[model samples]
Target: MTFGEKLQKLRKEAGLSQEEFADQMGVSRQAVSKWERDSGYPETEKIIRMGRIFHVTLDYLLNEGEGQSEDLAEGKNEEKGMYVSRETADGFLAFRQRKSLRTGLAWGLISGGLCLSIWWTEPGMILYLVLMIVSVVLLFSVKLADNPYRRIEKEPLVFDEQVKADLNAAFSERKKTAYLLRLTGIVLIAAGILICPLITTWVPLVDDIIFAAGLAAAGVGIFLCIYMTGILRAYRLLMRQETE
Candidate 1:
């Protein structure tokens, strides 16, 4: 394919119009049009910039013998599913991270409210109610409207071997950290629940304080577990999609 043809293909695949791409290249629309027509050639610097912009090698753009008719993003089709691209996979992971954080925070706030309500009675009850309401809002805020990869949730996905391998490698390290967090969270929850009974006898009339502190620890533990589990599951979900 000609440089013009390749340039046009890259720009379109990236969902950029002539004017938009021209702006990114710091050139006029007419200049971009001329380049796509093969009447004008960009300088070496611009060509290099183009390679970076399209996530392709210089050979793919400069050499005519390079992967002709086989574009970098060849739109790999699967038997009965959509081909999940690298861009899509990365975007999905980022989206899941944000979602998990919001979800974890919501659960944490609700759990923490239980301790708060016990600590101060009337005022605590009001704050607890406020927390509950805030938690609900946080949970509801995790919507798919802004997520570009929302379709991945419903569609069967296909992946290249390399992508799956990379994800697994990263997940190996991630899993260890996640497990550590999960363990620490479990310990905190257990300690919080045990604190009341263990300290009640020694600290007379301090039932409220003991229970409040215990519940607070439990809340933090719950948050850690929920957050870690969420991210852990999200990575697995991607791997499973590749497997199935």
Candidate 2:
């Protein structure tokens, strides 16, 4: 047995065609084919990546024989259905953080602009509208950070044990933060809704202004709740995959 043979076996066991495997590893099908044919060797980085993808160690990939091959074969028969990658988990974490920041900023800007627009004359309203447009543009920027891996949506490749533990810890902390954001948003929205009817009774002279302020708070709160929930759901899916 050889490294090429092991790679071929692992790829087959994973139920991926050469093309699909190459796509996952960010390589060409021809490159994978060449490796499997023993005509070319993968670079060190690729070798490491292959180790991760196949859930094997460097030694396992480097040393090969019938015994080791048979061991892997038996392992595969157990049919571990899916996997997750440390790289993918980290990437998802960063993406979610960036997106969360942008979402918060956008919501704050738009809501503030809306509140101001409510009180402004024509020219002032135009300025507030511009501010709101800027907020919308910020929201669009979320697409700028494109995900490079398939693991965020689907199951991920196998990660080293330590890497898996770290990812889980990080995700747990993030989940807590997400929950806090959700709670705060809910409280803000509840307060805003409750304050709406009270504005007239509490301060009749500035009823319209107070009402508009409440509306703005509620709008911001709604955006926060929606955005945070989306982030939480994505993390939850990954956690579920880890368990599976």
Candidate 3:
């Protein structure tokens, strides 16, 4: 019995084909097969890695006749160390921070623009309507930035054992909150649009007052939506830091 026989026995006992074992070892299937067939031997480093992957001692992997526990723990610490690396944690933190800053700046710009439009325009109602539409658009932009489509591609493949579950839970909560906020905004905007004709047509003594109050309520709702979005963004950023 030789190293090749030992390698084949470990692979079979672990329920892995040559290709599957090669992938875990980060080597080619042909390389695994060659090792198993006595055509070649893995380098010292790869042999150690194979031992870890198979949960066997180096002695058992090198000598066919040796027996050892297959439940030996090895790769867990390596995986955890990779996940908690400073660089990876820093990258996620930077991404979340930038997103929060961008959302806050967008809200400020929107609020200032609406104020200016109200002051400068002669028909303030029309300007207010335009501002409502613009605010809705900006909210959509914030949502998009928070979960950029490209992030699915760019996110780190490695996940920290301690942080992985927490990150997933936070993400789920944020998504639910965002959906509710968006739904509320959409409903308010639709109601406002339906009331536009009535506000324009009614000629009661208090029609002007009623119209002004409606516009003010709509404005407040829109602003509230923006404020809630900012809060959610900040919460997400803080969660990211906690995970790190």
Candidate 4:
């Protein structure tokens, strides 16, 4: 029999309707329907759990016509637990990466513009302003992209352990840089605060320029800290700590 036929047959022999089976499987009724209709594949984690529920081996579930009738009767049913599909996990990872990239690009453009503006005179400032506007538009466009797994927000996510570990390592390195960026930002802002009043009294024209540059530095620094914290939050979610 096809996997769907087998699934339906097993549910019937167990005296459970589709809705009851869905509850037992920790999935929505619609998700169960989709599975039994052969419209979708469950995440690998769910497939493993299903074998435990039905007293069948992974070979039986994945391969065709491999299990005995007594298998279901011999199985032990565990309490249902939350899960996210592999597709959802992948989509979320992409989303987080895109967000981080957008943030970095935006900050880079703004900082570069401000730094060059201080030395390049009026034309340099104008060019940087144009780049800043373009960056803003790109940021908005990234945010407007459709989310592939909106429903993942409602349930506990089940991501691969290796993927989470990789994310941890990558973000940990980023955290070091984020800390340094924030420190640099604070120093720039403090220097501006100290110099602005004194320079305004003695060199008013350059005071405004230095103060503007300091403000840009501080803003970029704050964003770096915020972005790093956001990455950490996504890492926690991937590790399923959000459920805890």
Q: Give the whole-model CA lDDT for all candidates, comma-separated.
A: 0.75, 0.71, 0.55, 0.61
> How well does each candidate superpose onto the true structure, as a TM-score?
0.63, 0.65, 0.36, 0.54
- lDDT of each residue in 1-244, candidate 3, tens digit only: 6888878876797566776566555568898889989999889978866654554667666655534444234433333211222233344445554554455445544543444343445676576677667666655766776432132233323443444566566668766876686567556545543573276546654565555445444544554465556556544543443323
Tens-digit lDDT string for candidate 1 (57-84): 6777887654543545432221335445
RMSD of 1: 7.1
Candidate 4 regions with alpha-carbon error over 4 angstroms: 4-91, 104-125, 149-151, 159-201, 240-244
TM-score of 1: 0.63
Residue range 1-244, candidate 4, lDDT tens digits: 6778777776786566776566546678899888889998899877875664455656657766645444444443322223433444555656776776677667656654565655666886788779899779867877887654444545454334564466567667766776676567566556544554345535655766766666565556545555655565555566654332
lDDT score of residue 71 within candidate 4: 48
* Best-to-worst ranking by TM-score: 2, 1, 4, 3
Clashing residue pair totals per candidate (backbone < 3 A): 0, 1, 0, 0
Worst 10 residues of 3 by lDDT: 79-88
Clashes of 2: 1
The runs of at least 3 residues in candidate 2 whose Cα sits more than 4 Å from the true structure, single-residue gaps closed, are 1-49, 55-60, 63-85, 107-112, 143-145, 201-205
Model 1 clash pairs?
A: none
Q: Over the full model, what C-alpha lDDT does candidate 4 score relative to the true structure?
A: 0.61
